[model samples]
Target: MRWFWIFAVGHLLLWTAVPFFTQANGPLDNVEMLNWGHEWQWGYPKHPPLPAWAAEAATYLPGGPVWSTYLLSQVCIVGCFWAAWRLGRETLSPSLALAAVAVLEGSIYYNCTTPEFNNNIMAKACWAMFILFAYYGIARGRMVDWGAAGIFLAAAILSKYDAALLLAATLLFSSLHPRARVCWRTPGPYVLTGVSLLLTAPHLWWLVNNNFATLRYIAARSSTSPSWLSHFEHPAEFLGAQLGAVAVTLILATILLGWRWRFKTVDSSAQFTRTYLAWMVLGPLGLALAYSLITGAHLRSMWGASMFTFLGVLLFAWLEARPDPALIRRTIYASAIVGGIFAAGLGLRNMIGDSLVTAPLRVDYPGQQLASQVEEIWSQHSNKPLENLGGDWWLAANINVYHPDRPSISAEQDHDLPAWTALDAWRTEGGIIVWETATAGDNYETQIKALYPNVEILRPLEFAWTKNQQRPPLRVGMAVVPPLAPIRTAELPTPAQH
Candidate 1:
């Protein structure tokens, strides 16, 4: 238990501190989320509202610290670690329970990719809680436990609609377990279902009323060719990615607990716990594969966030039949080695990435400078504060996050925007527009002019960003269209209303 807390706290600080200093302006999703969070809604075009709500809530601290969001991401990550610890402790020995969590730090999903406080990270925490509560509910037949499971399941779905894939897996497990099957007749399961539906009712209504915009966005993002070859190609690609993601953790676990597979005496209690872990982990992967095969959907690597939550427990349970302090110590050593390598690798990448003159990541974006210049230009033209921000998600998100007023975003080029504010309202209260320079033969400026024909196009501003002293500077081109008319409404959405 002492070691578990040490690993958990270390994981939290390492993840939080690295991104806080190394990332210049934070990742694109983090900025985009803060932009969405400026206004609260039941749903956004690409995902549900929970992630945005979480991001918005974090800004309530005195300074609205950028590191707070990163901290929030780590908080979610630590919650996942704790949930896995709790679940394993109940089913397995305490040492093995700690091992279950220790092994996961090496996984890229749990540590490397967690710095970005995106929907994927948020979903992981909710998914872990849902699985833990579901296990307790089914194992103990407790109504309170089942209710908590339902609530977290709803949170998972609200984090990303794809979480329904995991929920389907849970339903499959309920049917297969003899004891859990009896839950079908009890009010607990029914009430659990009701609780999930009740919590998600608003988002579901938004989906229907908006013509399932999120589904459409996902289809566009994941669309592939209709050829028969793609069915095989897509699923194979997905499987390969999944395997690669867990490769390090799998290798380390194999070293700690060799190729032997053992089962506890066919005790119903032991079997139930093992089955729950196996089914939840395997069921989702199966559904992902099925979806890939049937729809030829391009499965992104991030979707693997919840797939390996119970993998460590499964590995430790099969390898260690009896409590062995020596084996547990060895597992801890191996975990530190693997986790250290992962952390060191991440730090090296961030350090090297800052010096790369070519192919810079979003973390290198000079959002603060751009926001300052744009706002300065806007003040010259209008007495009112910047109320509306328009452009692409990346550029607009950059300005919105740092701009003084935290303007309402208007990514008009991107369709399926939720009615965070009325279009008429935007027209009445004109806003600043910003976009990158056009490449050769590109007419992004012409398109922006066409959209807002009444406004004048300001001279393009060429800003150079070089965070690391060793790197050659990056040149970014930006143009701003200052507000034409000013209208301030008492009804403008603010973080406080959320």
Candidate 2:
């Protein structure tokens, strides 16, 4: 238990502190999430609302520090680790349980990618917690456990739709096992299904009303049409990536087991635990592989985040014939090495990133300064605060997070004006239309000009990358659509005055 907490707390603190110190602001996804979180709905175009809600809650924590999102990501990661430890203790020794969690640190998903506080990170805790609850419910046939499982299952799905794969796998496992099959007659299974659907009903309705925007976004990520060569190419690449991602854990396990371990089918009572572990570990990964093969879809590396929550426990039970103290000592050393290597790599990346001439990282962008300049430029023409922003999601998110008003970012690609704001209100409120003049923003200056033909196009401003001044300056072009009515001084307090 002491070891478990040590790893969990250490993991949380290490990840949170690294990003807080190293990153100028948050990452692109982090700022985007904060933008969505500020005006949360049932769903977004790309993902569900849970991640946004979590990020929003972090920002609302008294002082609204940017580091809070990093902390939120760490909290989710440690929660997953704790869940793994709890499940491990049911079938393995305390030492083995600690190793189960320690393995997670090796994965970039739980370390390097975690501080972004995106949907993948948010879903991880829900995935682990749901698995733990579902295992207890099926094993013990307890109503309370089933209920908890249902709620968390909803949370997992709400965090990201990939959780459906796990749910399907669990159902398939229960159907095949004799003892688990008995759950069909119980109220617990029914309750679990009913609760999940009930919790998901609102998001489902939102999807229907909004024309399944999130699904379209998911489709955009993958190859919808099959290609003859991609069937072989995509899956092979995905498999290779998965192996590389999990190599550290596998290597450590291999070192400890050394081909000496064998699976023991002797214990009947343990069969269910082993089977459950196998299905949970294999299910999501198998689905991803199959999808890649069938559709030639590109499976993202981060999608593997929730798939390996129970991997360490499964490996320990299947292998690790007996505990070797020397092997255990070596495992700790290996884990430490993983942590050190990741820290050094991330530090080096941040440090050297600005010096390169190819392109500056989003972190290198002087978003706050740009926002201030844009706000000043807008205020000179219009009495009202910048009420809305128009551009690509990344640039809009940058302004959304830093601008004094924290205006809503309406992407040009958003088809439904009602989903963001009424077209009339947006036109009446009349805000800044911006596009990146260099590097990014999709070269949308022509589109913005065409959209607001009557609006005055301001002079293009060049902003230097704060961290990398040697790099060419980023040019930003803006246009202001005059507000319908100037805000009276007594009517509402300005953002600066507030």
> What lDDT, from 0 to 1, does candidate 1 have?
0.77
lDDT of 2 by residue, 330-408 (tens): 7766886797689667866776777865867866778887788878988898887788876545666788887768888
Candidate 1 — which residues are off by over 4 angstroms?
63-65, 260-266, 321-323, 419-421, 424-427, 440-457, 468-498
Q: Which residues of candidate 2, in runs, are more than 4 Å off?
A: 62-65, 224-226, 259-261, 264-266, 379-384, 416-419, 439-456, 485-498
Query: Highest lDDT, which number?
Result: 2
Worst 10 residues of 2 by lDDT: 489-498
Error of 2 at 87 (Å): 0.6
Per-residue lDDT of 33 in model 2:
84
What is candidate 2's local distance difference test score? Answer: 0.77
lDDT (C-alpha, whole model) for all candidates: 0.77, 0.77
What is candidate 2's CA lDDT for residue 209?
91
lDDT of 1 by residue, 1-498 (tens): 787888888888888888777777768788878877778888888999899889888987755446778989989988998998898887787888888888887788887788888999899999999999988888888999999999998999899977888988989989977877988887888878999999999999989988999999888878877798889898899889888888877876765566675555546777778778888888999998898899877888778887787888877654554466787777778887777777777767776765655656678777888888878887887788878776555666788887778887755533576544465645566776665544312665565555555666776676565366544443333434444433333232211100
Predicted structure with the largest TM-score when compared to the true one = 2
RMSD of 1: 4.8
